[model samples]
Target: MNAQIALMLGQDGVTSGAIYALLAISIILVFSVTRILLVPQGEFVTFSALTMAAMQGGRPVRLGVLVLGLALAALVMDVVADRQRYRAWIWPKTSLALVAVGLVVVGLGLSVPFDRLGMLAQIAFTLATVVPLGPLIYRVFFQPIAAAPSLVLLMVAIAVHVALIGGGLLIFGPEGARTEPFSDAVIELGPAMIASQTLWVIGVSALLTIALGLFFEVSLWGKALRAAAFNRLGAELVGISPEFAGRTSMTLAALIGAVSGIVVAPITTIYYDSGFLISLKGFVGAIIGAMSSFSVAALGALLVGQTESFSTFWASTYKEIIVFTLLLPVLLWRSLRQGSVEDDE
Candidate 1:
């Protein structure tokens, strides 16, 4: 490829890699805290993108109904079950407030004219609609098995992912969507021109990364999560609820996925299930870091994007093959280094 083409490819790859870095961080965070793989993390991406698309198209967004139904069910479940243990927990009460807020947002989304809603408002609506699905999943599905073996939790995560894929098709239909550009300007520097949207992607990723750093290093809740991840039983002994840690981690993962989706939707046609492949790429990047180091995972994700971008030019049909194949050597190296540990379960 020539210089211009290389620059364009680099730009595209870097933008996509930035998004992948967000996903990698999310995967690592959830895994660290909960020991659950959180496979459906990607579905939130599709959910946010398509739901936003539906609202922007002036259609009655169905998420309002869905969220309300889920809220009622969760309430009933809480009422019927050992609410004696859960009734006073702050997270449950906080979740209820968030659901109430989401209901209001979605209600407005369905009623307001699409043109009347500004771009940021639409984004906020989408965020509200999609982010709750995370904690809800943790509460309804994963929390019950929180003490299960890692392998069992992994199975639960896979099952959750499969269910969400089917549900996504039903909710969003098979059609794909692309959002209006967040920016349309291009900056020319010598022969290489960069889209402003790319700059937005990179800038937002940097800001979020820094924010996450601060939150983890400085915030009490962040420290709580870290403590939980390091030693769950110990955290619980210290009055830190594992359920709370898992729920919070899942919520943050959902937030990251939703934002990544919103940023990426404008750049590509996002189908009901588009998140699977994107998340798979992120997972591969996460694995490259041995799922432990944020900086390393970010670097691996950028490399994944760059490799895919260049490989598509060289062998379009085999680009995925090339991209995925990079994981093998990395995995082998990790396995050799870490050896194996048998699960007590």
Candidate 2:
């Protein structure tokens, strides 16, 4: 590829990777805290994209308005679902949580047939159905096995994936829907051209990341959640409930998904199964971070994005191969180092 073309491609890859990194951090956060892989995390991205597309009607809405609506809808759904499925359960809290989760999956499954609704309405319904469903899953599957092997919780997440995929197929059919980005214009740089939409994606993602980081670092509730994640028993000893932490984390995850979807939706078509693709990519990014630090995950995303962009320009077919090749070496080095440290200890 020409130098100019290579530069442009690299920039594009970096942007894409950054978004994936955000997703990775969100997923890693939940996993590290609860030891439960959150399968529904990608759904949040899909839900946000669909909602933004639905609300804007193929046109770009103001970013502020778009963010506000998506955030509000996601937050509301999360809070309501928590109360209904988890709080209302009478049996062992874990069983109740699972039952609540089942209700959500069933609910989303049913809503797929209502394709006639405008984008806004569909977005609302989807968010409303899924946000609260997390706690229910906790109550049902995780609760019963709370004391069991962490692998069991991981298995529950896999089950969630299976159910969500099946439901998407049943409800939305196999087709995908595309939404136009807010802007179609591109700006020329010295050696690369930047799409306005791409800039928006990068900017919005950065802003949200910064905002969330600040919140977690500075806010009382944020600290509580962190404490809960780090040590549930310790947090509870200080009166911070693990349930509260879990709920908060889920809510944050939902909002992150919404923002990611909004930024990514315009560039690609969204379908019921879009979550699977996103989940895979996000998982890769999260793993690159060793599934711990959010900042590291974000940086990993940037690297991945840059690699993809550059690879697409020079070797489109081998873009993924190239990126993973780089990732493999780094991962191997880290693994060996960790092993050495363990041996020394």
Candidate 3:
């Protein structure tokens, strides 16, 4: 391939890589803090994209309905599981807040002139409609089994992924959707012209990554999350609530997923089931880090993106296989290095 073609391919790689990096970081954050593989995180991406597309088309936004339903179920689960700890008259605070947020989002979806609204407003509405599903999901499904074995947690995560896929089908139907580009501007660098959407993706991903780093380093809640991720029992001993940490990390994951979806939607059509493969690509990056190091995972995701892009150019039919095959050597090296140990349990 010529230099211009290579440059264009590189641009595509960086754009898609930025999205994958966000997903990889989210996966690592959730896994470190909660030990639950967030297999369903991609649903947040698909749902957010579809929701934005629906708003742009002035169609009914069913995501609000899903959020409301999840909120109600989370509330019931919280009350039933923890009723002995609080007074019967007092509602579980988190669940109550989720329910309130759900109501507001639902109301907005039904009443707002989404088609007439500015792009920023639609993006905000999409975030509001999709982000809460993260914590609500954690509260309803994973919270009760927080102390379960890692294998059990993984199984539960897979189950949740399946459920969300069904929910996506019901909410978004069969059609694929894409949104308008965030900007029409393009940048010229030497022989190559870069799309504005590519810049948006890279800029937003970088900003979020820096913001997250600052949060972990400077904010109290971020410190708490760090503590929980580092050592759950120790964090609990020091008065950091594990539940709060789990929910917070899940919230961050959802926010990342939603933003990734919004940013990428204009560039690619997204269907209800599209998130699985997209997220699976990110999972490969997480594996490259052994699901522990954020920076490593981000870099690994970038590599995956570049590899996928070039593979698509060369052998379109086997691009996925080429991308996934990257995991084998990394896994083999890690396994050989660490060997196996019997479970203490």
Which candidate has the top score in lDDT? 3
How high is each candidate's TM-score? 0.93, 0.75, 0.97
* List of clashing residue pairs for candidate 1: none
lDDT of 3 by residue, 19-60 (tens): 999999999999999999999989999999999999998887
Model 1 stretches with alpha carbons more than 4 Å out = 84-92, 340-345
lDDT of 2 by residue, 61-132 (tens): 222232233334444445566678788523344434534444454544444443455545555554554455
lDDT of 1 by residue, 43-75 (tens): 888888888788777777777666665665655
Error of 2 at 143 (Å): 4.1
Query: What is the lDDT for 202 in model 2?
Result: 85
In candidate 3 the C-alpha lDDT for residue 208 amounts to 95
Model 3 superposed RMSD (Cα): 1.4
* Number of the candidate with higher TM-score, 2 or 3: 3
Q: How many pairs of residues collide in each model?
A: 0, 16, 0
Of the pair 1 and 3, which is ahead by lDDT?
3
What residue runs in model 3 are displaced by over 4 Å at the alpha carbon?
86-88, 339-345
